[model samples]
Target: MQGLKAVLPLLIFVFCVRAKKMRWCTVSDPEHKKCAELAKALVAVLPPAAVAAFARLSCIRASSTTDCIEKIRANRADIVTLDAGEIYSAVKQFGLVVVAKEIYSDGGCILSVAVVRNSSVDIRSLQGHRSCHSGARWTAGWSLPLGFLLSRNYLSWSKEQLLSQDVSTFFSGSCIPGAAAMAPALCTLCQGQKSYIRQKNYHCETSHSEPFYNSQGALRCLRSGTGDVAFVDHLALESIEGSDRDQFRLLCTDGTQAPISHYRTCNLGRGPGAGMVTRANFRKTARKFLTTAQTLFGPRGRERQRFQLFNSSSFGENDLLFKDVTDKLFVLPDDMDVSQVLGLDYVALLKGLGHEGSSLEDSVVRWCCISYAEQKKCEQWALSIKSDPLVCVRAVSMRECIEKIKRDEVDAVSLDATHTFIAGRCGLVPVVTEYYEKERKCVPAEGSTHLETDVLPSVVAVAVAKRSSRSIFIGNLGGRRSCHGHMYSPAGWLLPYRHTLSLEHNSSSPCDPDQVYNSVFWKGCLPGSQGNLCKVCMGGTGEAATKRCADNHNERYYGNMGALRCLVGDPSGKSFGDVAFLEQHNLQANILSLSSTGWADGWTASEFELLCGDGRRAPLSEWESCNLGIVPPNTVMTRPVLTARVYDFLMKSQETLAANPNTEFKLFESQQYGESDLLFKDATQCFVHTSHMTARSILGGEFYSHIESVFNCTHSDILEFCNQDICSIFE
Candidate 1:
């Protein structure tokens, strides 16, 4: 018995040693030796608890995807972290599973343009100027900024265009491989070297070390005049501040609305950002671990920690890694018909929600037919039951529609909210509303009754041109003279004094109609005149005129009249864009200006500011006001009823307006001769024809066509057969 006990203790020791060696072997590889060293360095800097947790967890070390795959094949590791771009490449090459992801909020890159402060180089004026970038791989560092410049025609790739024309280009390898590297880099760079000198700060410095070196080196090179401009990330600049702080200035930056980088842009398949991946054999296990780990290390978990080592600030609490990955994963089907049947219009829906359009139509059609049928049905029902009544309503013409509404034809009309508000006054009402279900109440429309849904309250308001004479009088008194004079007046006030005969002995008596009328009605009958006109002209002209008019008439008229000259002044002072001018003065103001300008100056700017009560001028942004309040234009992009083509047409109209030099376009509306009903009939026919096919069926056909364009299919086509079935079912 004593001998057996001794043997058991020896066996237990051997097992423990084997387990320790196995754990080390799983992560230690010749190719990943550097990564292992990096991991160890990271561990040394981590808090005691984090270090303990990391030690307990398995480590995955690999140089390339192939090496990672090989280790996984031997059951070495389960989880792998990589840059999103690299992962895409690796997955495409090796068919690996991506179980988790870490998306950067602003395109996973940090691009900055370094220029000498007070240099003649305006960041925008640097178009075609010699620029050195840190290569395309550094997405935030270079690619995104370059792409933005290219899109804006600020940078050109043509050698001929660049030659002798202030264009030069260079790329230096700077920035780290992933966002994990960038986070620490950003902290270190902003906080400075002094903050990172301590033992606790070493982890951040090491994590950001690569970016620091690249940024520091690049800035030094730029300062030395090796390049005209340097495009890099924040870390690079931060690293070299002590040496070249005074010499360099950030000319432009991504994710800021400053003058230097007013509009930053991004694209797919480039830049440094971490992503999640799992071993093919251990995907399920990896996913489970990630899910569990996220719960333990998520926002709630960090909230419980007295002092968080990773996320000291709340910024990382909602980082893409934890939020996006934790949400549901939707895998689109390979078979177009299947996707359609399942209602997967993933791309189209995104586009509808204001994303740039891709080939989302098929997906949208499928989703419309299948997945979103109930929602669509509800929307259609609500629209059908709307109380306001949807009809083919029009004003005199397109321009008149804008103008007459400004003139106050009816209370309000339902059109594209963007268009109406873009062209209408600020208080125009929106017909449809939108809201999140959890946040608000939704009232469904009953048949033939327009029910207001509280789910989405109209962000826009409806306004009518002042109607009451009192209101108009007050409005006019308040300096809206043009509106008052054009819309209001009393008739027959001067008729009685038309033929007043005045008898003067010396000269032929000239009868003054206005004077006679004012005298009789306004002046008290003092009775001094010759012949029949004597009785009519009872009092003096000034006193009679004053009493004859309405109590507030003079006040209203003079007050409004005073504003006419101001209104006629140049409307283009504010530099407020197109829509502003349209909404403020309404269509009439612009029309009058057009007519007056044509008569006087021959041109009027689209948007202009007019002087108001104070010395300060309020911007007359009619176009902006109209656009902001309009519904169709604002909501059309998201509406299912408006087809992609229709939405495109509307957007193109706005673009055309913006691009036109005069900021004005003549819209001619006319009926087809002898075919007034033709338009309606044709539209109805098309609607009926399209309605016969289910969304899925339409998608199936579209997908088949797309596939046929790409690859010749010899096998019996599944999409074509499914299309018929879908059509029949929908019909």
Candidate 2:
């Protein structure tokens, strides 16, 4: 009896663990009935040991897919199947994760194709013809076909205008269900409520009330000669009853026609089919339940005569719990997020179609500015640009600017090396890069452009010091005062500080570069820093003394010119910095302008010297050989969807405004705004459209590898979060 008691607790715990229950959320009565039938049938066929691997199946009824999403979010249910479009919303808006995807015989994706009865119609000539679509915003039906047309320039659409308007115009009359309110003519051919066609509410609904509301329904529209062409999944053609299938053909983008069986080569883009979503934490549970369910009621199920997992014909409907065409449920990897499953290009297409928000505006490119002075300069530049109106949007910091661009609040911004890395990690791409070679007209060349061939125009990062600071060498500068442009600026902090960290140091905290800098330097001015790092910072002169340690232009020592001011000493001549880490682009110009602008009494270009990595100091003019590293030029960045448009607008602005010296408003010049580089670097000679290059490619392999090493060890919260987010999705 005592031995039995010892193992009794273990036996009970194992029994409880094996008795887990899974609640499958269903959208309709048919799905609920089919789910219940499968739930009962699985229990009778699977042995106790086999059933222990999965949860006891149960059904939870919901009114619609949106309701199902909410139930699953609230944890009232465990798993649910959704359309590809609904899956996007479930994952993005509801924080749900995709566990598995329904796959047909071909694969996990479905081929979107345009079907027609007549073979003479070319793909480009579909305009002004009646069209049939599966449904509004559906992947195979509407989004894919429309995205293909818009991306290929077969249909014209402006970001400022509604896509429905362009689509309504593209087709003279159509059977586009669920879009009656957006465009009524799109439902002209839709057979609404077969027996009650006069009811406008049922005319173009997404439900059975509208005859031409789904893939099968859309094919019926094409067969009845109600529409000239039908855009639907390739599987929908298989539903054609016998001889009626011979009347349909597929439309190819290359202006040719192919038989329905040749849809693999003649179709719109292949998009992810229906996906199964659950709460992120419940993914394992959902996966196990799906795997076990597939084993029992699947095609070769032991209880196939009782219930079918993928079929719902017994329930008096098609595609009840899952798509009838689904051959199997392919479990996705844990790392595959909604974006990965749908693909970045497809997500970009959805965003361009204004699914979540409008990422691009044809009327204007909202330029993101970091500071008040930068915003003022951007506003001024906006006024001067003639093509593609420019609008200025303000953010508090560079990271915030990147976040705004990611959220589609702002269109584009110019980012330096360090922030550009973070932006790329956050999924933004470079549209244009600052060119420093020389001024040239924006004309087509026979050979590849500099950017196309990956010949980046780089600026030299130099460690500058006053000629009098003789003891401050690159190797032995501990306990000496330092100057930096700002906290995260490439030349001011990232490059130079990282290079300094590469040298030997005995500090306990070696992971955090900021802490190491603060510990090594006695007192220095590094704007946007705190405590000792901001000790040498001279805030605004008069009433702005309280603005010390600020991260913007309000601080006197905040940029390349500001770093030079720190090395030149304060106006009271009380505190002088030992070294100034800056770039070589405007070094001579800023040094010469100091004396003329009255910021310094007797400043000369010869008063400064560059410290080389070999422990020897060279004159400022020899920075090409004595610098720390060659930093890539600032890049204009935006969401992937807006890369082409932003690049075009910038190219236009350069040709019409900055290309000519006679124009009063210069796109690159920023001295008038009381800052050195406001919207763009003042030394920028031209803009290189980097349509083919990513932020990593623009930084080049050597520089990218160097920065990656530095970033891997540094303790930057934003960069860490961005990297972690990226790795969780992509890696």
* Highest-scoring model, lDDT: 2
Model 2 segments more than 4 A misplaced: 1-135, 138-156, 164-319, 322-352, 356-362, 387-389, 446-454, 497-512, 540-547, 655-663, 720-731
* Model 1 whole-model lDDT (C-alpha atoms): 0.29
Clashes (backbone N, CA, C under 3 Å), per candidate, total: 47, 0
Cα error, candidate 2, residue 518 (Å):
3.9
Please give each candidate's TM-score: 0.31, 0.66
Alpha carbon lDDT at 97, candidate 2: 94
Residues 1-731 of candidate 2 have per-residue lDDT tens digits of: 35435533543454346456789987556668888887777666554553453336788976445667889999999888876877887887889999988877767777799999987877888888889998877789988888767544567676666889888888988997767767877888887754342332456665544667678778878878888899998877777767776888899977889988899889987677888999988887677667756755778654566678888778866667788888888888898756668765456567767777554365678899877778788888777778888889977667778877766678789988878888988777777788777755434467743334347678988898888878878877788898898877888877775555325554676545687787778889988788999899987754333477677766777788888888887666666688998889998988876666667788888888999988889998788789888888898888765666686788778767845668677777777766688888888877776745667888877877767777777767666545433112321
Compared to the true structure, candidate 1 yields what TM-score?
0.31
- Total backbone clashes of candidate 2, pairs 3 or more residues apart or in separate chains: 0
- Can you give the lDDT of residue 581 in candidate 1? 11
**Tell me, what's the RMSD of every candidate?**
26.2, 9.1
Error of 2 at 395 (Å): 1.9
- On a 0 to 100 scale, what is the lDDT of residue 650 in model 2? 82
TM-score of predicted model 2?
Answer: 0.66
